[model samples]
Target chain A: MTSLTSLASSRTPADLLRTSATAVWIFLVVATVTSWALGTDHAFVDNTTAASVVVLLLAFVKVRFVGLYFMELKDAPLPLRALIEAWCLIVCALTVGFFLAG
Target chain B: MTSDVIDAPASPATAPGKKRRIPGEEGTWIFIFGDMCVFAVFFCVYLSARMADPAGFAHDQAELNQNFGAINTVLLLVSSLLVVLATRAVHSPALKRHAPRLLAGAWLCGAGFLGIKALEYAEKVHHGITPQTSDFFMYYFVLTGLHAFHLVLGLAMLTVLIRFASKPEMSRGQFIFFEGGACFWHMVDLLWLVLFPLIFLVR
Candidate 1:
């Protein structure tokens, strides 16, 4: 929560929203593109585990950005924010671990 | 910069140094949290199912078009972004008038998602793939179908919020409702973000 105030205060609510949303949007787009490339590229196809981990990890991070900004959890009550953070960490870790292990 | 400043006058709850407060009713978060827990269990069920027959699951997964999932991920993210803009716009007197349009755009993105999903669904059905087709198809349809149901609800909620938010005179109560709805919509998007990779991309 305390870590995110700097970037959010630069503009009016709308401008700040637009700025943060745009930043997240661009980051998501880049992550998706990278995932697509890694998913479809011939060389990467041979390494399914590596490709899967990379793409899934990218998705995990994108989820964090969405939760923090769009969900308005950055400034949420500490317990709520902590809950979300923990959920993300657990879900991502469990899913990736299961994917690789199974 | 430090936790001390946050506790100085604002207390830990307000974190005065942190200028913004979490929007919407705290009660709504309980629902959001509950929904997250329900979905987590669903994901676990999926993992268990996949582990039983990894080969079949992987084969059926390849049948899904990654391009579609990739496209929809961006679409949902953009929608959530627009909702964020609309929610925050209500906070600024100068930008209040623009909230409705931004929200409408967000709603349209939700519509776009359903449209793409329908097409994907139709293609699968045309190939004789259905929930009855196999275990993977069952999970695919059931999981995504449930998610689609949530997306529709999210859209309707957005529309309601837009109606009140766009008005020349909105109550503080209305603004809070709008914020809550926007958060719900983003939760829908967040669920999909996790679902997309788990169901479509991960090998």
Candidate 2:
């Protein structure tokens, strides 16, 4: 399969931008639906490790959407995109890792 | 002899536009990275507070209105769609004429979000569940308040885009500013997606 950036850039500018937005919307909807379903307490507050993991994974997905499409990383040069993604992964991993470790 | 080859468009010898790079765009990414760090600290604080007093956190969390939170998430999702459509419309030769509609739709969606959020706050206040009532409430107020403030700013940015869209002489380069603002707005939206589950949905 063609790489994501190559596919995006190959489209007319209009399609590229539309695909970017629609992808995020779809991702958010799926996340929200999954979260609502996995929620143990619809009317109350309950915390389960399963729910926590799901939310964390959703956060990662959202981060990817913002970094790739909204921030135009899809069109960015390879080194710049790599730099941004690397920093984000380190920050997120450290934060979540510290919490989980503690 | 090789000069002709060097003149080719694909040749590395050719200078790119302006032959200069912008560091401000690079700086914005760093700024965003810093913002993420601050949010992480807050996340840690939230987690620890809950861990120390899971019972209290759960009680306080129960006081939240999930219906409103769900509605707001939907609104933000729609607004994200509008922003995407607007960005796409700008690039269309035929649909470019309707760019104003696309942008206006985005602004409307953003404004709708603020309106709904205010209603949610008002409902909470009416129920006597003020932020100071508990530590969970405190975090909820601060986090959601900041998010709402960003929405307000995002709406204002959309207004600016609308103003430019109405102009006859606006260039495609000008849309980059709108795109930058939209990117920040999307970040705001993404933050809320995380907040909704962490604060309202999960135990």
Candidate 3:
């Protein structure tokens, strides 16, 4: 249904290198930069709860992206993939709740 | 639960109704899941302590080197990217030749992370900000110190892997070892992603 499916099905090493892994790396760099900017500006101080949520949300996104792609869990069985995603969601949510309500 | 992607002896002959394969042993994932649970408990303990003395924690956190933390984060992410590239490349006969170089590059990035970490630790200790300085420093050292230990172990594991893979052909078991190592390193990076923000940013 989508181009990514075609890309993923393509087994060429160059294709994999130039596609998902690169895309994930770019996203990670951008996310890190964004978080660093927020940290430097001290936005988290303006509203501690809101800032904590944003920062950790970004963290959650980074972790999930790496796990799914680099770890190749995208090709893993449904049960395993579900378990990994559930771990990410639960840990991120509870950690944020801890900081926000701690 | 693993694959012939890297060490097929030769590619598996196509057949209908064959089971799909995983790259590494099932045990690696199980071990990581347990390790993460332990770290989660550590995180909750740290937060509970921080909650009891938020101001003090914040004050100590401010003394940390954020720029160094940011650099280490990038280093680990780059290393992870290289490991994934190496893994994917192993499936292609045309590009498997490049996997060794990709792995070496990843090792350099990991080394860079540890170098910066050592500098950061030395700077703090020189300034008399050891773990004994406060509860904040205590958490900072214990949590990050444990993490740093894993980073060192990861680097060592990669060293062994790169050496093993230097052969013209790696065994299926060796490929699985490579995959498991990649997962472990990524977990290390994953831990730091949250740790960086929690300790250095989320004041």
Question: Per-residue lDDT tens digits of candidate 2, residues B1-203?
Answer: 33332111122134344232221155565656566566756776777776677788888787777777777887777777776666555544444556677778777777887888889889889999888988888888888898788788888878887776666544534555656666666767767776777778656
Question: Candidate 2 chain B: worst 10 consecutive residues by lDDT?
Answer: B4-13
Cand. 1 TM to true fold: 0.87
Candidate 1 lDDT tens digits, A21-67: 66778888888778777766543468878888988888778878888
Quality class of the docking in candidate 2, CAPRI style: acceptable
What is the DockQ score of candidate 3, to 2 decimals? 0.44
Predicted candidate 3 versus true structure: per-residue lDDT over B1-203, tens digit per residue: 33443444224333233334554778998988788878878878888898999989988888888899999999999999888777665555556677788889988998999899899999999999999999989989988889999988988888877776666777777877878888888888888888888788777
Residue B77, candidate 3: C-alpha displacement in angstroms: 0.7
Best by DockQ: 1
Q: In candidate 1, which residue ranges exceed 4 Å CA deviation?
A: A1-18, A42-45, B1-16
- RMSD (Cα, Å) of model 2: 6.9
What TM-score does chain B alone reach in each candidate, compared with the true chain B? 0.90, 0.82, 0.90
Order the candidates by TM-score, highest first.
Answer: 3, 1, 2
